[model samples]
Target: MQVAQATEVRKNWSSFFDQVVHDKPQAVRRNRDTALFLSKTHMEEILSQYRFTLEYEIEEDGYYSGGLKEIDICWSEPSLEELKQTIAKDLVEYAKTYMDNFALYHNAPNRRDHFPYVMHVLMKDNIQEVVELIDADWERT
Candidate 1:
């Protein structure tokens, strides 16, 4: 494994991808304390393990958001199953975290009496996958 920063990764993305295809994973680091990378096989395993279906909403700015609704419980990929399971578990955990934060902000003593509208908006949309990608730190971790 090798470590690189976000800028370095951007500059050498082609070489990095080539290495990934060759089965060598490169770790991306930021602030000298983070790490991120994944082997090609590991990525395939994650895709197979989850077997999730997604629905998305597109905004006027051409951006999009989506989430997993129904998962294929019987999907079986021996090598990558564990990775997929971990991702799914993390999704639920993160959703709960959002809920917790909403609670905190909603109940803040200095805040207005209005209910937490942001939490409602988040809950109304399915964004588990987005959360995973955001939290995963795609480049430098």
Candidate 2:
């Protein structure tokens, strides 16, 4: 509710930075556009509650197709390792694509809430980490 206009924010950039980085998120308004500035740490912590799971189905001939719970991306592979690796690569690619067309994607109603999940993938070091993050720890018999 504490929204600062664009001009006031620009004039007091340092104070805003200090408040956002050290204290909490700050809201800013420019024209009709409004945005919130929050730290990456806070974002990660907030998104931590959301689990990145995968849903899979086995084809008649033994092939498997799976999709990420957080994003709509899917992959098909002959084996579990290959499937995980493929999905990881796909997630990395999708995250980059999301950032590349941020304005368009963010404005989309279906994808607006996906920013947290996309950032989770984007913050990863590599595809391997992504694989591990979404890796199933199922204890199957």
Candidate 3:
């Protein structure tokens, strides 16, 4: 293993990568061991110890208000009962999804223009084989 200062590695990243590809693993550090630069084959071997899967999902549209959309507020004085009802309604909506679940996110809209998405998780066990096939495709590209 070779040791390299993090700043030195950053300044000559291409040469560092070339060294890692042809020579040996390089340990890059600042105050402590920060990262390791390893050969592709070594990286594959390390990754082989754990299982990985390629995930595919279809994004389905859901309700979303783009951040630019704003609600207009009425400044008219309201009775105490009306104020209580408004607060209650807001509390219900917050408990249903707003408080914990709903958050702002942006992505390319679906076929029918909409922002929110429903993600489906898909996994395959043959990750290494798939990665090699993708790598071949990448080389051609």
RMSD of 2: 3.7
Candidate 1 on 1-141: residue-level lDDT in tens? Answer: 557787887898888877766766667776777665766465555444333443444434533333334421222223233334444555455445546776674576643232332222233235444333322111111
Error of 3 at 94 (Å): 30
C-alpha RMSD of candidate 1: 17.6
Candidate 2 lDDT tens digits, 19-77 = 88889988999999999999877777776665578777777677777887777878779
> Which window of 10 residues has the lowest lDDT sum in candidate 3?
114-123
Q: Please list all clashing residue pairs in model 3, or write none if there are none.
A: none
How accurate locally is residue 83 in candidate 1, as Cα lDDT from 0 to 100?
36
Alpha carbon deviation, residue 13, candidate 2 (Å): 1.5
lDDT, candidate 3, 42-121, per-residue tens: 66655443321212122233211111011111111133233233433332333333223434322322211211111100
Best by TM-score: 2
**TM-score, candidate number 2:** 0.69
Q: Residue 60 of model 2: what lDDT?
A: 66
Please list the Cα RMSD from the true structure of every candidate, rounded to 1 decimal place: 17.6, 3.7, 20.7
